[model samples]
Target: MLFRQVTHDDLGCASYLVGDDAAGIAAVIDPRFEIDVYLDLARYMGVRIEHILETHNHADHVSGHGRLALATGATIHVHRLAAPEYEHEPFDDGWELALGEVVVRALHTPGHRPEHTAFALVDRARGEQPWAVLSGDSLFVGDIARPDLAVDRVEGARGIFRSLHEQLLTLPDSCEVWPGHLGGSMCGGPGMDMKVSSTIGYERAHNPLLREPDVERFVARSLATLGPQPPNFEAIVSLNRGPLLATGVEATPLTPRQVELKKGEGALVVDVRTDQQFDEAHVPGAVCITSLSAGFGSRLAWIADREGEILLVGRDDDDALNAAKLATAVGIRRMAGFLHGGMTSWREEGRPVATIERLAIGDLPARAAAGELQIVDVRERREWDEGHIPGSVHTPYHDIDAIPAGIDPELPIAVLCASGQRAAVGASLLARHGAKHVLHVVGGGVGTWERAGLPIER
Candidate 1:
């Protein structure tokens, strides 16, 4: 048996390749968007990838199922409940995939999504003692799965309760549980302890959801505890299953002369800078998306209307190059060029600038001391609990889009993070989402308050 786990640090997600050496047959579970990793592994192991499996339709990074199948002439197998926009084999409950001596038994567990499934591996050559169960999003390491998917949040929560109790919880106490994601993930609540993998027995004793049985209480906790979804989440989901769009491959940096010439060609320029830099002086009609946060690509993808000739106007040439590559990675390819000279060069050419007021950390608690600030802590919930400023509400950076529905745009919004990096990301997302009165806490949560010697809250 050949087993390898691929973990993506940015999203804290996991995918696995389980192969049978004698049979030269292998199966992949929950693969990532980049097809190269899986392809390389299969070739090195001298195995033909015959089956593709998804624990569930992923909501974060797009799956490589469609592309891999097209590349390898393999069969795509998802649970019967999953209705992928593309072609796939619907494996019903109790379906078995035999890869030589390695047999993977499919157990349908619908909690995270209606079509969720967990694969229990049986090394028939050895014994019936199962080695591991690919829990997908249906089960995480320390925390139970998040219930809210594309369906009604309340209904999903209830479904999760039944799924957890009737399906997942019934598994043998010894089955090793390999979940789809880990801690720091926006998918689950901040209660998650471990990040990689755990066993059914371990989770039953430590996992909060498995510990709770009251259906109403379980549903309430699941619904109320989840963080907000990332902006343009539905759009990304649609694109994932849609036809392949190439991220411009190994995009080259553009020069200022090229940007100047292309300005007349209707190239949409995105200025990723601080609000102060943006408001004071910037290219007319340029969108401001900072080079911070995971959602940077997602937001830019949204602002691009999912279609446009994107020209990255970075803080410098390096910024332009990164933006170009990132834009391509997320499936946005219309990168025409970048502002070669940056704003400085643009200014030498008599181009304008914009400035917007930003808040430092000390300025935040001072206003809080004066009862005149709305400090938005956009870090993960666990980070917030560790050491956040007093009176700051925990609103994750990814949830910036949904915040307008509940958060008042009138309140002076000061976005914060453990460090200022993600705060810059959050502030840009909020501002682009149409929140006018927003500021990035530059010194981050700790820096500003420490300098001010303000009353610190644990």
Candidate 2:
């Protein structure tokens, strides 16, 4: 038996490849929209991919099941409740698939989504007892899946409670628990762990949610602290359920002249460079989404207009292409292309540019104290609750489409997050939304403000 876990760092999604190398057969679970990784792995292992299995219809990112099936003539497997429109063999609880000595048993764990399922892997060569379970969105290393994506919050919470107690926790303590998502994913709550895998015993003993014995309290607590849903979640879910989407997006290289025409035609330009580089100079009205972190896909999805086409501007061909791929994975399909020579070429051609002015945290405190600046804390609610500047208003970065109430457009508005990355995004959003005086706070945020003996409003 052979096993490999493939993780998409940006989305914090995990897919699995389980196979019987001796039998020359393999199966992929929860594949993303890129199929090359799985195909390459299959080739190296000298096994033919014969099956594609999905624990549930994903709501966060597009699945590459269709493309993988088309490429390998593999059979797609999903739960009957999922009711996927694509060609698939629908199975219910206790459904099992055998590949030589490897057996996968489906546990109907409907919690995160109404049709969610978890797969338990049993290597018969070793023993009849199961060794690992792909918990899907049902369980995580430190947190459990958020229940409100596909159904009502309370109802979904109730379902998750039962699913955890009746199905997942029933597994042996020795069983390895591999979840569908990690820390950066919106699928789980804030307490989600970055570790990819954990033993069932560890989670059972240490996970906070798992320790709650009461069902009603579990339901209430589960629904108490969910973050905002993923951007375009409904559309992403619909696309994942409606049909099989193919991969292979070739971003055409657009000349500076072509880029200008597209921009005039209402294409949104996304600059995927470092915040420092983007703050230096960029195309006018372009939104900067630095692709250096795992939040790149979600950040782009949050900022870009889904209905409009997007033109990517990056440091080079590879950077632009990477941005395009991440965009596609999140269902942002209306890609125009990428700039051929990047921003340098645009500057050489004397194209107009825009630069966001950066302000250091050291100066922010004094201006904020003097009531001369409207500091916007664009971090999350939890972060805000822990610490924030005295007069700053809290508006999460994702929700910065308009000026917050009581904020004056004429006054200098400084945007700051944990670091300056999100502040760059927030500042640009404010600028595009017609905030006259926006400043991107660099150096640090509330933490730095507090460390420097600056006053903070708890």
The lDDT of model 2 is 0.90
Cα lDDT of model 2 by residue, 1-458, tens digit: 98999999999999999989999999999998898999999999999999999999898899999899999999999999999898899999999999989999999999899889999999999999889999999999899999888898888888998999999999999999999999889999988999999999999999999999999999878777788888988899898898788766678899999999999999988899898888899998788898877889998888778898999999887899999999999989998999987889899999888888889988887777777788899998978988888768899988887888878888889999987889999998887777888889999888988888877788
For residues 1-458, write the lDDT of model 1, one tens digit per residue: 87788876545678999989788999999877667888899999999988889877666666777678878888888886767767778897789988888888888877667788888888888877677888887778877677766677777778777766776677778878887777766567767655577888888999887788898888877766677564445655666656543233454466666765676687767886654566566765566676544445655654564555877776678877766655644556667777775677787877554444567765676676777767788777756665777767777765555454446777777777876766765766666566667776775576457555765567
Residues forming the 10-long window of minimal summed lDDT in candidate 2: 242-251
Alpha-carbon TM-score of each model against the true structure: 0.76, 0.97
lDDT of each: 0.71, 0.90
Error of 1 at 292 (Å): 7.3
Residue 103 in candidate 2, Cα distance off native in Å: 0.4
Top lDDT prediction, candidate number: 2
